[model samples]
Each structure stands twice: as C-alpha cells, then as structure tokens.
Target chain A: MISTFIRHELKAFWRSKNTGKSIAVRIVMIFLILYLFGCILLAGIGMDKILEIAFPNDDLVKSFCGIVLIYFLFDLFMRLQLQELPTLRVQPYLHLPIKRNTLVGYLAITAVFSMFNLWPFLLFLPFIFKIIAPDSGIIVALAFVVAIIGISVFNNYLALYLKRKSNLNGWIFLITAAVLILIVIADFWWHFYSLHNISYAFFGRLLTMPILAIIPALLGIVMYYFNFLYLKQNLYLETLTARKVKIYKSNTDIPFLSRFGTIGDLAANEIKLVFRNKRSRSSLIIGLFFMFYGLIFYTNKSLGQGWYLFAGMYMTGAFVVNYGQFMFGWQASHFDGILVSKINFSDFVKAKYLLFTTVSAISFVLTIPYVYFGWHVLLVHFVMCVWNIGVTTTIVLFFANRNFKRIDLSKSGTMNWEGVGASQLLLTLPLILTPYIIYTPFAVFKHPDIGLALLAVTGFIAILTRNYWIKQLEADYYSKRYRIAEGFRNK
Target chain B: MIEIKNLKKIYGNVTVVDIPHLSIAKGESVGLVGNNGAGKTTLFRMILDLILPESGEITSNGEIVAGHEHWKAYTASYLDEGFLIEYLTPEEYLYFIGGLHQQSRAQVDETLTALGDFFNGEILNRGKYIRDLSKGNQCKVGVASCLLQNPQLLMLDEPFANIDPSTQFRLKNMLKDANKSKGVTTIVSSHDLNHITDVCDRILLMEKGVIIKDIATSSSTLSELEDYFGVGQTVGATPVVKIDEEENH
Candidate 1:
C-alpha cells in the first residue's frame, strides 16, 4: 500500500503542469540541503574541541549536555515554520476495503520523513561516537542516541498537531507564537529560571544511568498516538467540506477614498484584494517586516554612506517592489472583465499609481523613528520614498506587462513560486542596481551629498513628467494585453 | 453596434475565428449556436478586444476597438468565471460593477431586489464569496452584474450552460426586454436549440471558424439546426452538410 502511494506521488509531481519549473527549483533545493548537512557534520565532528575552547574551566561533557536541550528548542522553532503536513487523497480510499486506521497510520509514519528529523543525526552522531563511546561505554552511548531520536520524533508530532489545531482556529497560531516569545523573554531577560541548568539535569542523567532514556522514547509514543487519534477523528469528508464555508463579513467602505472618484474605487478594491487573499496578505506582511531592514546597516558605523542609501531604499520601498512586480498578474483572474468593462485603461494605470504612492508613503512615515540612528538615515529614506513612487513604480509596472502567469491567491506565499517568471527575476536587477549606478560616482569622489541630491532631483523630474510615463505604460499595456490574457486563459 | 471586418484569429496552424464581415445592429437580439470548437468564444473575445486578431480589426460605433478606451464605456461582457472577481461577495461584486457605470448604492440595491427571483434567493446576503458559490449560482452573479451595467452592448458566452431551467426562462425574458425596451444589443451563445430559438430574433450557425448559416428565426429554425446537428438520429448517421449549400444559395 505504501509503495503504491509513493508511486502515485511521484507521478503527480512529474505530471504537474509546471514540471519544468519545479524540477529547476528541486535541483537548487538539493544543493542547499547538501551544503547545510555538510556544515552540520563538520560541526559534530569538532564538537569537543569547540566546547573546550569556549568553556575552558567547565567540563566538556557537561557543557555539551547543556547545549542539547537548547539545540532541540531551536529545532522545534525552525520545524514549526518549515514542516508541512503529509497529505494524501484518502477520500478515494475511504469507501474502499482499506481500514481507516491504516490510512491514518500511514500519514503519521510518512510525516516523520522530513529534514528536521535528519538534521539531529548529522549534528549529533559523530559526537556520540568520538566522545561518549569510550568514556561512557558503547551501551550508554547507544541509549543516548536512542534518546536523541525519541526527542526528534516527539518534536515532529507536536509541531504537526499544533499546526493542525491552528488551521481550525487561527488564534492557536498567535497564542503559540506568544508563548514561545514569552519563554525566550523569561529565560533570557527576566532571569526567572535557567534553561541550561534544567537541560543538564535531564541529559546528564542519561550519561550515568541508561534507563532514564526510556522517558523520551515513551513521550515519543504518546505524541504519535495523539496525532493518529486526531487524524482518525477528523478524517471524514463532511468535516473537510464543512470547514470551507466560512462566513465572510462585508468590507466597509472608506469614506475618505470616495473623494477621489473612480481611481479611488479601483484602489479601494485593490486594497481588499491584498487583505482578503492568503498569498497577497503574506506579501504585505513580509513588506511590513522589512521595515526593520535599516537596523542591520544603520547600526554598523564602518559602512560607507552609499550602503545607508541601499538599506533606506529597501526599507521604504519593499512593498512597492514586492507587491508591484506582479501588478497585472494579480488581476489575471478577471483581466477579461477589466478589458471589456466601463473602465478606461488610463484610469486603471492611474489607480495602480495611486496604490503604490499610498503604500510607499505609509512605509516612509513608519521609518521616521530610524532618525534616532542618525538624521542622515531619515534623509536617505525620504529620497528613496520619492524614488520608489516615481522611478521604481514605473520599472515594476513595465516588467509587469511581460509577466502573464496567473497567481492562485488561495495559496500561502512562503516558498511559493506560482506566478513567478523570468521577468520577475530580471526585474530585481534594475530595481537594486539603478540607484547604485547613479549614486556610485559621487560617493567614490567623496561627494556623497551630491549623489543623494541628484537622485532626489531625478525622482522629482520623473514626478513632473508623470503624464508621459502614463502614456507610455498605456501603450505598452495595449500591445501586450492580448498575450497576457491568452496566457492567463491557458491556466 | 459592433462591426468585424476580415477578423481572423489563428492558434498555430488552425484558424479559430475567420469571419470576413459580421455586424450587430442596435437593439438586435442575436443567438450564436455551434458545436465545440466552433469559434463562438473566439469571435466574442475578438469583438470585446480581449484577443487580438491575426489580420483584421473590430470596431464599435465606427471607432476601432483596439487601443481605444471609448468603446469600453458602453460595452459589458461575461464570457466565463474569468469575468468574476471571485474573492468578492455577490453583492460586493454587483456594487463594484455598478459603481463603474456611476450607479448609486441605492440604485444597485433596487436592481438586486428586482433580480431576486432570477437569483432564486441563493446569491445576495449569503455571506459567501463568489468563489465559494456553486457554478450555477456564480453564473447568476455574473449575469446580474452585466445587467447592472446597463450597457448599450452586452455579450455573454454560454450563459445557459450552467444555469437552472427556471432561471434560463427568466434570463430569456430579461434579454428580450433589454432588446425591446432599452435598446441593449445582446449577443448570446448557447448549445440549447430550443432556448436560442425562443430568445433570439436572428440566429447564426458556426462550424470550424466560419459561419455556415445565418437565418431569421422562424418556425423551422430549431428543427433545421437539429437536422444539421443530427440530433434524435440513429447511430452512425452523419450530420447533414447540405444545409450550408442551401443557406449559401
């Protein structure tokens, strides 16, 4: 049964419409995984030497034991973000002769085959052989290895359970994140208790008495059973279909936008599109998170002024670059209606301009607190804001005309390459490099202020000549609209 | 109000729409009937300027449709689910479309109240996005939005394919009333011979990418189309092609 399921999965992957693109992504991912595992293996082999150097006065084995729990804690955090639940088309098999328990058991077992489960062995196995075997004897070392495997399994099922619960009620996700943050703060900032000492107390006993290792193994069994029960209870088609009929509240109208007329209406709809869909909502969240980007460079006093410009540009314009690159593709689902409706193409272009400027302006205002780093930081962000509105908006929309792939808005954005095309990849070049090209010569000659002035002037001039750019965009859109519509139709 | 001149759209080697000249007059209720792959959709797309033709032009009210924004002021179309903004609720979608035509919210609500029976109580105030609605209900939303536009030119492709029987009757009446009362030029394509014969004053039969027959609707129109399609015939009976010759003569 498992072999048949694996064969079907392989066929689905190979037969998918985006097989060529997925194959390329897979090759890149494989190289990345190998590189990460290679680093972990080297770290494992040299663990004793590193421990001795870092903790010169403390016992090496005790320090290593203290780090084990910390490693797993970090492992659990990473797993929560990266792990995917194992899904099978069990509907077809539910009415067949196969037992429901067998399907649930299959899902639970396959869920264990993830990179999170493999990283522990790569990072801990060599340490176990070199340090623990001769000192604690082979049997004790084996028990320690069993404990590591047990804890890894426990973490796997626990993360999957929490993720499933969160899917049913979203507050579970927020509460889990809050609890994790509180744990970090209580241990590190409040000094309420010490996790390192607690970790040593648990793992150090395994080194002396091998029987204590059974505790983690037992915990692993309990989590596995919990997941199995959860799956069996919620396996019915009724539960699956019933969860999708969520009661949606109508979006309230923004009275302020009514003053702008049709352009305002279009922009208001775009805002709802961003908030209502999973992929677009995540994109907006990521843009908001990038407001902290200046913290990395602005804190470093050694960097040149040009580096500040780069960070400031990114901080204020992240949403413009992130969301604007897929401008027309976001509307691919209704592009036909847009083409034939009572809307002028120029008004459509104006609405996009309106959305970009509004978002960029809000991003700039949020970065005003960065002036505490230096007044220069705020000045640079202001210039970048103008550049984003006038220059980057045009570049992004220009590249948008070439992107025809339709985005499925229902899917999450993390690691999703659904609407991505070569145009999206190429768009990043001019966006990042164009400012540097204009700013480099002045910085090299020690006249950095002149470069900033020149950039602001260029942006100002573009703003003044906005009508010309709008006409150019309208023409470009008309020429490529047919091809874009055709591509969208194919999907 | 729509004119096509030598309009041809080719997909690789096959020409999908190759009409030399086809014109729709004001207030004309036209029915387009054809089998699968008969270029009915491609022709509609060309007329709406969604698909650029290989070697010709389409015009609305004597202005070229390509690169012109004025035509959109009077044209409204619903070809498929692609025409719907699926994330919006039915009421929200209707209001959005109505807003484009400068219709007030009260006006839109009044129109919805009138369309309540056509919607069959499944659409408005349902607290469901259009994407979550069933196919038949989604079609009702699409058709209702087109009506809200109050467009001088309205086009719909296969609107009856996914609708219920009673709703189909209501839609036929709506199209007829739009043509007679408001002078709205409607182009509807359907596979149902009975519905097309009842709703349309003129019917155009398409084959491959060409119009094989064009006739005024009469008592014999439905049977003539049925004969060409070989409906109610015994197994292995070929569709009659002589109707094309007769129509040409």
Candidate 2:
C-alpha cells in the first residue's frame, strides 16, 4: 500500500505540467553536469600525464568519493530550500483510503530518486572508472555512490520533515539555523584538515575486498529508516498550520527602506516583497552572502590588479543580475494592478534598478573594509560598483521586463527550472561575456585601465539612459501585463 | 465617462470575455454581477487596464487605456488586498495611497474617521501588519485605501466580501456618498445582487463571460435580480447568506 501511494505520487508527477518541466530541466542539468564532469575528468587525466601529486592512489580515490558525498549533502540542503515540498497535495491524499504513513514513506522513497542524487554519481563514476578500473575496484565506486545517494535521500527527507515540523511550530528559522551551524562545522573541519580525501582513504581500505562497501551502505539504510520515522510522526495539518502562521508573521517583519518617504515607501515595499516573499527572499539572502564571494579570489598581492577588478566585478555583478533579473515578475502575482496604477512603469523599472544599485552600493561599501589593506582595491570596487549599477542593473531590468512567469517566492530555488526561461539565459550571456569579451582585448593590449574605463562608461550610459529604459519598460509592461497576470494566476 | 468597445480576452484558445460594447457615464454607480467565472473581474480589470483585451479598446474621458495619458490623472482600483502592500500597517497603507493622490496626512486621517467603525476600535493602532490581519480586517483596509484616494473613477472587485455586516453597511453608505455627493464614477463587482441593487444606478448580470443582462437598477424591479440569481424574493434577498454560512463559525 505504501508502494502504491508512492506510485500514485509518481503518476501525479508524470501528469503535472510543472513536473514534466522539472523532469526536462533535471535531465538537461544531468547531461550538462555530466558533460562538464567528463571534460574536467579528461582535463584531470591530461594534467595527471603532466604532473601527479605524491598522495597515494587510494587516497586520491577516497578524496574523490568524499567530495562526491559532500556535494550531495549541499545539494540536498539546497533542494529542500529551493523546492519546498507540495505538502498541500497531501491534503487530498489524507481523505483518500491511503494511510498517512504509506504516503509519507512513498514520498521519502521518491525523494531518493531526485536529480540531486544523480549528479554526484555522474561526476564520481567517470573519475572512478578512469582511475580505479585498473585497480579492479570498480565496485567500491559503485557502492560508495549508492551509499552517498541513500544518505542524500535521507538528508532530503529529513530536511523536508524538519521544515514541515518547523512550519507548524514557528521554529523553521531556528531549526534551519541549527542545521546550518552543523553543516558549517562540518565544512570548517573538512576545509581545515583537507578531509575531502577521507573517502579515498576508506575506499583504499575497501579495495582489497568488495564486501567492505556494505559498512557505509548499511549505515545509510539506517538513516533512511530514521527519516521515515520522522516523516510518519509529523505528517499532519496541525504542524503545517503552525508553520504557516509563523511564516506569515515573519513576512511582516522583514526590514525595508521605510524612512525615505514615498520613494522610500516604494523602496520599503520592494524590500518587503523581496524579503517577505519566500522565493525572492532566498535569492536576496544568497545575493547578500555572495557579496563576500569576491574575497575568495581577490587577496594579497593578487588584489588591486586588473584581473581582480574585472573578476571581482564579474563575480559580484553576477549576483546583481542573478537576483535582480526576475525583478517585476516576482510580483507577477499582483503585477496587473501595479502596472495599471498611477505609478509610471519607468519609475517602477527605475525603482528596481535603483534598489539593485542600492544593494550593489552597499556591497561595494562593505568591500571597502577589504580595501583598507590595499587602497588601490577601492579602484576595483569603484569600477565594479559602476559596472554593476550601469551595465548589470540595466541588463537585469531589461530581461526582468521580459520575464512573465510569476515565481512563487516560497517555492523558488527548490526545483531546477522554477523561474528560468530563454530570455533569462540570453540576459546572462551578455552579462557574463561583456566584461571579458568586450573589454579583455583592450586590457590584454597596452591599456588595462582603458578596458576598465570602457566598462564604467558603458554602465554609466546604461544608468544615465533611465528614461529610455523606463519607456521600454512601460511598453513591455503594457504588452505583457495580461500575460504576466495570467502566469501569476496559475498557482 | 468610460467606454469599452469590442473587448475580447482569450486564455489558451478559450475566450474568457468578449464584450461588444459598454459604457458608463460620469457619476454612474455601476454594479457588475456574475457567476464565479463570469468575466466580471476580467471586465473590471480591462476598464482599469489591469488586463489588456486582445482586440478592442477602452477609453476613459477620451484617452486610451493602453498609455498612461488619461489614467495618469484619474483612476483608482482595489481588486484585492494584493494591491495593498501587505507588509504595511493599515495606517501606513492608507497614508501611502493618500500620499499618492497628494492627500495630506491629516486628510487621510479625517477620511479614515468616516470609515473608522469599519475597523473595530483602534484597529489601525493595533500595530499589526495588514498582512497579519484577518481576512475581514484586510478587506476593510483595502476598501479604506481605495476610498482614501477619492479619484474620479473607482473600481472595486468584491469590496464587501469578507467584510463584517456592520462594515459592509458602512461601505455601502460610503459608496453611495462617493457617487451621489462627490460625483465619483464607481464600478463595483459583487456576487451579491441585492446589495448592488440597493446602490448601483446600473446593474450588469454576467454569466459565463458574457453580460446576459444590463439593466438600470432604477428601471428594473428587484424581482428581476432575484430571478436571475435563482433565488426567491425576500426584503432585499441576501446573496451573501451563502457566503455568511461559510464566514460564520
């Protein structure tokens, strides 16, 4: 009966339009990741021919397996955040002859088969086959993959159940904070000790005999049962109701630019929309954290150089485009009224660009602390801020004008293809390459500053041409208002 | 005056609304009535240019709805609390809309005074975000926000839905004053025919994406609406009784 419920969910997924889209997206992601991994593996093999690290062969393999498992854990955590489970569907199933345990059990089982489970294997299998096949230990790779996938399944279900439980108890953020702390601790230990190679160490132990793979595999099975128990106990409406109320309350408290008068009011409203709305808020938070990502590459003597400026700008600006690219469509749910209101569509677009610029400015200011060690770093931050405000904001707003799907902020980041479309991709192409493709030639030749100047100028022009962009946004809003509204009305 | 001519809307090969022509004179209190999917909301949205009709045009005071030209100076709509920025407290939302129309904060306060009872005692002072309010309270805030603007044209979709009985009666009076006293052209959509019959100068009965009946409320007998909704006459038959059954504990 449990299997039947699982099959029923599978059937429903197969029938859903969104599920079809999800599957297509998953398949594409799988192939893309696999192709990328294949290329990387080939590169690694080529690199191995040129240079080999002195670490033992088994150590490398175990390291490879450990990396695969770590990626799976991160992927599972992200999947939980991005694709909040459709617990609403359970409402109907509850009334059916189906027992709750059967439904939940099936859900957990189905979770194991998610694409998050597939990609790690794609990356791991090729590396194992390339390196370990000669050792006659291919089964270690296969068994490790299975165990990692099982643990990932366990993690996904546990995270979802915990989220559901938190939703009921208004402790979602608290639970998430706890989980994040644990993951951070794990990451800290892993990074400090270079323990990514631990799996290779374990696999080396297992290589002599295939039966040793059973150890981790059996542990994975135990964790899966624990997940099953958690889901079974908390599968009720009462818990979910608690979560809903808490979510509703938190939504009200999200900070915004409330002090700026009417424009401030508007900005505050946009801030609330970005924060209170589940999907957009996650992107915002991700963007906020991503501000520090530039520091990863720009450090010490390498900092303040042309490459650092461009790379830092590109990295940070990528976030501006990433989070701001969806802009108005994030409000597609009520975009009709917003479109028709006395507010100018240009002002609306301007407001978004302004907000993105504001965030970029804040990010640039934050980077100033990093700049103190090298005052020249401020030059990079200055140029990047201009590029982000000028080029990135315009590009983001341009595609944002074209985006029609009303993304459910709560459900965003969970599913693979939640808010993606052709325009969004096309928007990204220019954003990624423009800094390099257009400016690199100048920089590579005699004048690096000229390239930087060009970036700033282009971005400046984009920013200065606010009226033109506004007109364009208004036209787009008029043309697509109904389509946008219809998209939002879907769910 | 507002004019809608040959308005048609299609969703995935299915036409949801196709109206040949419709017009409401200045100061006309028009009530839109329809079944659940009967294109009433769609029509109101069209008038506000919230949704564009595939083929046809809507004009208000001689300006097309597509551009901001006419709508710039005159038009206000509250289809739902979605139009209300949910994070705002009721006071903030009211002031925000008031500020949009250049209403002084004092005027905003004075206007809320007229509709004060709609919110129970000091609901605005409750410090609860409008989003955190119960459905009934949310609707009251929305209604108050829309009315606060005092624009020439007002569009409210199911304004009275979720509003308590006392508040509903007060909103009706407010609508009546906005029309009769201020000469505001008001188009309101509701499933409750009697409430509309009591206030609207013109009543349109919509069925399945078409206006089956467009009768002046002053000309048509109350029995006509009763018959249309498939209900027998009472002293102003309450269509909301069905809604009340669900709203009441």
Candidate 3:
C-alpha cells in the first residue's frame, strides 16, 4: 500500500506542470555545479606536479564540510520551510481505502528526494573522490554522498516535524534565527580556529585504513532512521494546526504618507499588501538579513574607504530591485477585480516605486553606523538609492510582464519556490549587471563620479517616467491578460 | 443590467457553458438552479467578468463589461473562499471591502450590527484570523463582507452550503430585504432547490448549459417545480409549465 501510494504521489508530481519545469531546472543547475566542481578538483590534482602548489589539506576539507553542513541545513529547511502539504485538495482521499500512515509515509519519504539533496552530493562527490581514493574511488565517493544525503534528509524531516508541531510565527522565526546564528558561529570557529582539523585528521586516518568509510555509511543510516522517527511521530493532521491569524491595524494614520493625497492610500495599501501577505512579508524580512552581507564585505576589506560605500550600497539596494520587480503582478491571481476597480495602474506602479524607495531609504538610514568607516558610504547609499529607484525600477517593470505565475499568498512566508520560471532568471541578469553596464563607460574614462551620476540619472528617469511605463504596462496587460489568466489557473 | 451573448466556455474540448442571448435585468432577484457541471457558476463568472467567454461579449450598463471602471462598485460576489483574503482577520477584510466601496467604518459597523447574533461576536472582537475560523464561520464572514459592500448586483453561489441554519435564515431574510427594500439586484445560484423556490422572484432552471425553464415563483407550485427538475411528476390540479428541452442554439 505504501509503495502504491508513493508511486501515485510520484506520478502526480511528474505530471504537474510547475513541478516538471522545476525538476528540469534543478537538473540543469546540478550539471552546471558538477562541471564547476570538476574543474576545481582537477585543478587541485593536476597542480601538484605543475606548480607544486600544496593541495588543500584535511583542514580545508573539514572546513568545506562545515560550510556544506550550513548550506545543507538551509537547503533542508527551505524544502520543508512552510511544510504545507496540498492536503486540502486531497482531503477526499482521506475517506478512501488508503491508510493515513501510508499517505503520510509516502510524503515523508518523498521529502527526502528534494532538488536540494541531489545537487550538493553531485557537486562535491568528485572532489572528495580525488582526495580519498584512487583504486576504490567509487566506494569512497559513494560513502561521502550517502553521509551528506543522510544529513540533509535528517534536517528535512526535522524541519517538517518542527513545522508540524508548531505553526507559531514567532517561534519559527526565533528557531530559524538561532539555527542560522549557530551555524555561522560554528563555521567561523572551524575555519579560523581550526577546531575540526584534528577530528578530520583522525577520520582521514581511519578512511585510509578503510574502517572510517564504513562508519560514515553506518552513521548515515542512523540519521535516516532518526528523521523517519521524527516524521512518524508528528504525522497527525491536527498537530499542524496554527494559532489564529492576527489582523493588524492599518497604519494609514501616519502623517506625510496620509497627507500625500490619493497616492497615500495606494502607498498604505501596498504596505498592507506586504504585511498582510505572507510571501511578501517573508521577502521583506529576508531582505533585512541580506542588508548585513555588505558589513562582512566592507569591514573585512583593507581596500580604500571608498569601496566600503560601494559594497554597502550594493548590499542594501539589492532588496528593492530584487523584490520590487514582482510588484503589481504578485497580486495577479485576483487582479481582475482590482484592475476593473476605480484604482489606477499608474498609482499602483507609483505606490510600488515609492514602497521600494521607502524600504531602500530605511535600509540606508540603518547603514549610517557602518558609515563610521567613511562618509563615502553615504555617497554609496545615495547612489544605490538612485540606481534602485531609477534604473532598477525600469528594468523590473519590463521583466514583470514575463512573470505570470500566481503565488499562493497563504504559503508564501515559508520557503516556497513557486512562481520561479525562466523569466525570473532573465529578470536577474539585468538587475545584477545593469548598474555595472551603465557605470562601466564612466569607469573606463576615469571619471567614476560620472558613473554614479549616470546611475542617479537613470533612477530619476524611472521615477519621472512612471506614467509612460504604466501606459506601456496597460497596453501589455490588455494583450497578455488572457495568457496571464491561463498561467494563474494552471498553477 | 448584464447581457451575455453566445457565451461559451470550454475547458479543453468540454463545453462547460454555451449560452446564447441571456440578459439579466437591473434590480431583478433571479435564482439559478442546476446540477454539478451544469455551468451555473461559469455563467455567473462571465457576468461578473471574472472569466472571459471564448466567443461572446458581455456588457454592463451599456459599456463593454471588460473595460468598465468601478464595475466592482456595483457588483459584489462571494462564490467561495477564493474571493476572501484568508490571511486577514474578518474585521480587516470587512473594513477593507467596505473602504473599496467608499463606505465609512461606521457604515460597515451598522451593516454588521445584526451579525452579533449570527456570529456570537467571536468573529469581530476575537483577534482571530478568518483562515483560522471554522468553515461555517468563514462563510459567514464571506456573506457579511458582501452585505457590507451593499453592491447593486450581488452574486452568491451556494452561500448556504457551509453556513449554519441560523445564519442561513438570517441570510434568506437579508437577501429578500435587499431585493424588496433596497432594490439590490441579486443572482443566487445554488443546488438547493428550496433556497431558490422560497426566495427568488424568478427562478431559472438550467440543464446541460442552457436554461430549460424560466418560471416566475408566483406562477409555479412546488410539485410542478419538482417535476420540471425531472425528479418526478405529481398528480394534482396545479397547472403544468412548459419546459423547453430542445433549445440547441
């Protein structure tokens, strides 16, 4: 029965339009990663004779393993992040002859075969095989893959069980933050202080001796069973019940925004949409985490103080362009009524642009302490603000047309990979590259300030061209409304 | 007023709805009755302009239904929970929908004033999100939202399906009051024959994507209506109504 259920589930998954595309993307990504890692491994092995460059030692391998562990945890958590099964649609099956345990077990096991699990092992197997074996290379590589896959599966089930046991927002946030902090600290300790070196050396000795390879494989089995137990214990549907959803008071009472006339109401709605929708709200929080990435790049660099400003601007300004691109389309599922309503699409775009500006401005304000490194940081922040609002907004609006996937707002706060398509990939290239593209000519001419000025000008144009772009959007919307409607229904 | 001409909706090769020249007058209380897959909901969606018909045009108030700004101002619907933003607490959604219709918070409060008995006040002051509410309570919130908007054209598909008996009674009366007193045009589609029989001024009997019987409530007896439904005929002095079974066009 369990096997049959699993077969049925896999068949359903394979038949799904979104799932099939996602699987194809994952396969391509794995191939690319394996190719890149293969180059690194070959370089390590071949360089021994050419340059006598010391091969990465057990310490580096152990460091790599620790970082990989952190990556695996994030991946696993992401897979089970929201842990919302498409159970409602399958509710009728509950009354069928199929047992609950069989259905639940199938789901728990299928969770192990996630896109996150396969790529890491595929990427790392060749490198580990090079380090460990020559004659029995396949066996050693198999052992490493088994162990990592087991660890990832364990984390996957553990995250799912946690989500099943408690759907409390505050608790989930606290636990995720705690896990992230611990992983970061452990990674730093292992890398700089060499805490894991001796342990890996011992493991390496055992591996050469042929006994430790057996141990990892055995440990992998144990972790797998441990995760299986966790899932089995928490499979009850009622266990996943969340606390009542909370309604927040509208913040339209704020001055300035309230005084901005009709634009104010649209701005307030945009903020409410972000707050009221789980997916948008989650991105906002994740954006906050990304803002600190600049701190690491800037503080650790001995490069001139000017570089700090640039790095900081890039980090903080990243969120606006990245997330703001989805804009009005995120509300596309039920957007027909909104479109037909008295509200203007121009106002919708303006409100979104304003929201991006507000968020980026807030991020800039928070980065002032980091500017203690130099006042050039403020210049970077100013430039980033302009680039995000002006240049990034135009690009985002252009690409927003390509993204038609209707995100399920209910499941958005968790690690949902829904609505990601080839279009999103196309959207990312220009977002990441356009600033450099626009700034390069000025850089080549040895007038870096001119590049910044151009970025500012581009942003200013986007802000001013709001209606022009909205008109273009209006024309595009009429033409593609049927297709967009089709995409939403298919998902 | 809404007009649907040659409205055909096909899911792949299956034609779910294939109506020709159906016009609903303003301020008319109409009930749509059909079995599952009878295309009642599909026709309602076309009139509401939620889904476009493949080979038809729909117009509301002399304007193309597709382009009318504030079409939603005159039209409010709750076919299912899809129209409700589940993440919001009932109060928030209620207020939000009300604001969309340019209604004040006080107006919404006045509209919801009678819901205290129906909901036991748990929905409003209880700090609970609408998604967390029970199925019955959620339906109540859906009904309350539509009522708060006070739209001219109200489309409800199976509103009583998940609602409690008490709320159902309140809804029946409220709908009747809206039609009679406020002149609000309502189009209610339900599988429950009694709901349409008891409330609608004009009940439309739909079968296989076409209206088979368009009988005024006052002109038909309950048994004759049942016979028209093809359940069975009854022997009585009640007049028999003609049901057009061959309107292929």
For DockQ, the strongest prediction is 1
**Model 2 chain A poorest 10 in a row by lDDT:** A246-255
On DockQ, who's better, 2 or 3? 2
Query: Cα RMSDs of all predictions?
Result: 5.8, 6.7, 7.1
B52-132, model 1: which lDDT tens digit per residue?
Answer: 889999989999988777887787788999889888888778888988988999999999999989998999887888888
Off by over 4 Å in 1: A17-58, A70-74, A88-102, A122-138, A178-193, A238-245, B230-249
Clashes of each: 0, 15, 1
Better of 1 and 3 by DockQ: 1
The sequence of per-residue lDDT tens digits that candidate 1 reaches over residues A322-400 is 9887778788888887888878877888889888999999999999999898798899999999998889998998898
Cα lDDT of model 3 by residue, A1-491, tens digit: 76666577778766654342665566655677688667655654553232222334434444444444545556655655544543333344566887656755565566665545555665556556665456446665565666665565566556655555445454664677577667657756656443344445544444445445455556556655665565456544444344322445332343556555556656765676677667788888887787776667666767643454356555666667556655445675556445434455566666766777777788878777766766766776777777776667667766766667777765554434567666776676777777777777777778878877777787788778777877887677666666665566555
In model 1, the Cα lDDT at residue B2 comes to 81
Considering TM-score, which of the candidate structures 1 and 2 is the better prediction for this target?
Answer: 1
Q: How well is each residue in B9-66 modelled by candidate 2, as lDDT tens digits?
A: 9878888898888888999999988878898888877777666678999889988876
DockQ for the candidate 2 complex? 0.29
